[model samples]
Target: MTNSRQKIKKKQQDVVRFLEANKIEFEEVDITMSEEQRQWMYKNVPPEKKPTQGNPLPPQIFNGDRYCGDYDSFFESKESNTVFSFLGLKPRLASKAEP
Candidate 1:
């Protein structure tokens, strides 16, 4: 696969892995399988978020009809420990594990 494709795949995997690890429910939409879904994603993404040259790529995060963000934003939130808020999810309560 091309480098771009590889990067996209890696990003998608990272997002999925994190969500799975945290037990967050998510729907993985494959735009390639349905043009309607693809168009809906493109349309839902804000104009400011879209690339200047072409349509936005996959792995776009959302909460129902609410637009969360793209991979870059997701990564940023992850790094800053705010991914739950970024995903529009309430953070889970801490369990008693000596902390």
Candidate 2:
């Protein structure tokens, strides 16, 4: 089985191809990094194993802050509620519930 990074890379490639075929204008960002480099950057990185059910998505860095999202937006946004829903989690409520 391919790692999450590898899987995302493949999907990116597919998107690029689809865009090119349709004459869409876009820029492709290559965020691929070596395993050693990733380890040096992040401590306690998990091994590249097959993803399991309910496995939390990876961490993301945005505007100098670290956040976690679902596999879809994990590498993109830190403010997306879709990520929370994807992980079977609910957004926190601001007001307390009344009994």
Candidate 3:
């Protein structure tokens, strides 16, 4: 695989890992296999979010019909400890330990 393809695959895997770890339910669509689904994703993505040249890449996330953004946004949310919110999920309460 090409370097860019490898990076995309890694990013997709990372997103899946985080979602699974947090027990978030999501559907994975393989655009390469389904042109219709790929077109749907392209149309659903906000115009501002779409690339100027090519169609938007994979790992495009959504909560139901709501767009949650791509890998970079996901990584940012993870770093900021706001992934649950980013995924349109209610934040889980942090448990307190007895002193």
Candidate 4:
């Protein structure tokens, strides 16, 4: 496979790892090579929400019917602990261990 493909695959794996580690269940889809899904995305998603890439890649997320951006946005949400709230899950409270 090409370097770009390798990179995309790695990113995809990383995102899955993060979700699993957090005990968050998610669905994965590969639209990179799916013309049918691409057409569906073009129609269902707003143009701005779509990536500016050649083939708008996968990892496109949706909470019910609302688009939640891509993996990058997902990561951002995870980092900020916003994903938990976004998914209607209780945010984990940080343990206050005396240092």
The clash numbers for all candidates, in the given order, read 0, 0, 0, 0
Give the alpha carbon lDDT tens digit for every residue of 1-99 in model 1: 479888988999999999999999889998989999999999999999999989999789999999999999999999999999999999888867895
Candidate 2 lDDT tens digits, 1-99: 889777766656654564466454554433344565344324332334215553322332222222222234533322453433433346445667788
Q: TM-score of every model?
A: 0.91, 0.32, 0.89, 0.64
Pairs clashing within candidate 2:
none
Q: Give me the overall lDDT of model 2.
A: 0.41
Please tell me which model should have the higher TM-score, number 3 or number 4: 3
Ranking by lDDT: 1, 3, 4, 2
Q: List the residue pairs that clash in candidate 4.
A: none
> lDDT per model, in order?
0.94, 0.41, 0.90, 0.71
Candidate 2 has what TM-score? 0.32
The full ranking of all candidates by TM-score, starting with the best, is 1, 3, 4, 2
Model 1 misses residue 47 by how many Å? 0.7
Please provide, for model 3 over 1-99, each residue's C-alpha lDDT reduced to its tens digit, 9 standing for 90 to 100.
Answer: 479889889999999998889887888888889889899899999999999999888789999889999889999999999998888999987769879
Task: Report the poorest 10 consecutive residues by lDDT, candidate 4.
Answer: 54-63
> Which candidate, 1 or 2, would have the higher lDDT against the true structure?
1
lDDT of 4 by residue, 4-97 (tens): 7787788789878877998777777677668786777666666787668754565566666667667787778878979876555677777698
Q: Which stretches of candidate 1 lie over 4 Å from their true place?
A: 96-99
